[model samples]
Target: MKKSLRFTKISVLLVAAISMSLTACGSTGPKGGAAPVQAGDESKLFGLSKTETPDELYEKAKKEGKVVVYSPSARANDAKKTFEAKYPGITVEVFKLKSNDLMDKLIKEQDAGLFNADVIITKEVSGAVGEEMVKPGRVYKYLPEDIAPNVDEPFRTKDGYANYLEMRTLYYNTEAYKSAPVSSWWDLTTPEWTGKVYLVDPLSSPAFMDLFTGMVVNSDDMKKAYKDKFGKEIELHGTENAGYEFIKRLRENKPVVLKGSGDVLDAIGKAGTKSQAVGVAVSGDERKIEDDGLKVAPIYDIKPKTSVPDAGYVYMAQKAPHEYAGKLFIRWMMGEKDGKGAGVEPFNELGSWVPRSDVKSKNAIPYEKLNMWTYEAKGFYTNSAKVRDFWIKLK
Candidate 1:
């Protein structure tokens, strides 16, 4: 009887060992899935969909009651009023900020696990946005089924929807020059335009960083434009590439770094102001020509691309309290069914380009005819810090 019992114990031990070995051989992963390191399935939380109609979301959102947003647009208040008007029960609480400030606040809130915002609509500081938010599963993408067809494929990122387009553009004083005094980007680096060029602080402004980082990423284009302008290959100094070289030279020449866009405009746009000053981007446009009596005009014809495509993107918060309401607000803000939705009317202004093909820009420049590079998050992410360091060390 003792021997039989010992054999039974041995048999059970052998079976258990075999089962453990088989389990190890069958799985190479910790959780034993094909995609082990990817972000978890957040679709259930975000409720992402193309087919989910406004009516469907509205029913759920009405129950959810209110939506909160963090956006950079001055017109966000107008959008809030319009959205509240459209949906009787749903109220909007708006937190307007510049792109950088918005990112900072969102990151702080996310770090503290304070998920108060339902939506975030900021101008694209693509690299920072992707690195800080999207990759961490802090935000999720959803474009409405009704509006998806009209938006171009490139604008529809897996991370978010590009709702509109703006630029990292250069402007020349019409009061100073009969036409653009400088024809190429390199022209700003030369002695002739030195002290005449005005710019916002690159270190502080996300938009300027986007521009400088873009120039670095498209260094090849900068080289080509340099050769076109100078009729020789670009001679890189301590800088690594033509883009960096251009930035260094522009800095050496002392582009008057100002505190605000209004300051740059006042320098370049005041009527009969004969400074011949060219200003780096700060969001002023030719509508100033009509309304503010400023004579600034965009340099659309400059080489190495017309402008950096600084897109305005809308994203749903990953852990939103009012998920349905958030999605509803994004759809409404994206100019709803016909691109004639009331939510977009507030944002329709000169220099801003809507993503929907049907929605026309108030700017006079032909969209297709303009040459500009698409916003590249990875490229900017890879090099923005290096560019920032270079800018600071030089400064």
Candidate 2:
């Protein structure tokens, strides 16, 4: 009888222990549960309060000893060196890859329960990051107090993460056209530009697709530009919006489509080139003109607009092993350490405009001249599929 009583007691204790363990796991929240963060509580958990000082963050970050970043730019390596120098003993490791590849790798690694990356920086925030990662709670949105006030609302997402702008403009061979050949976007579709225009294949580049979508979203502006240029209202060509009509017309014009922007730049910018092609590529590609002995310049003084600005976003991983370090790195990257922090130096090389009001880009075209489009995460995520389908059908 005594032996039977002892066995019952042991079983009861085992059950009590299991219940406690389950309770503990349940109460530990998203980090431990691998669930989406409670909406209102994210800032409290990921961001430093106004009262919290940088020294406090540094202490926590130093304890992690290292941070791993996945980005599409080799410029990340420059930021890594700057970050390490700023915080001795905390190492920064970067994995550079194309935007699509970076997203695939992160998703695959996260699925395998390998949270190797602490931070991810890429141009697909509106598409891949918003739809694939942020919506699913695979990453955390963090905005440092130092940077929060400096950035405008439109430049960031609802969650407080920043999106840095990259400008794309039309480039013309300086020798062939002393002045810009096209004054307005409509000029690209005219008979003179039928076979002389160059651009990346929209089906292959999400950035280029985003540009098209931006035009669609701003159809009113497109319509106005059309009226201003041609002295008449735009006649939609089997499409509801002027942007789509413009895209249809431009595509029909048979512009040279290339797989990559680099090739587009080469074809349009190479010195002594016989082709008088005007290509749309990253504004920063101007850095290559002199190096390649090409006399190419963007139409910075165009009437309605010169270029479109697309933003790249940065986010911390949901279950980052070095959460504090990731926060520190992001803060540093946003120019938080000092007014002109080293963390932002590499990005400066790309001539991309940062969201910070205080920081200025050294690109040839001024920020005001560019038609900047602040990325709307939801709009881009929802409209990308429809746009892609349209592009495929048109192509």
Query: Which numbered prediction scores highest in lDDT against the true structure?
Result: 1
Please write out the lDDT profile of model 1 over residues 47-99, one tens digit for every residue: 23546678898998999899989998867788889899989999999999877
lDDT of 2 by residue, 51-150 (tens): 2345776898888899899988777787888788779989999988777778778878888998888888876633546545554556656665556666
Off by over 4 Å in 2: 1-52, 111-113, 156-160, 301-308, 365-369
- lDDT of predicted model 2: 0.68
Error of 1 at 273 (Å): 2.2
Clash totals in order: 0, 0
CA lDDT of every candidate: 0.71, 0.68
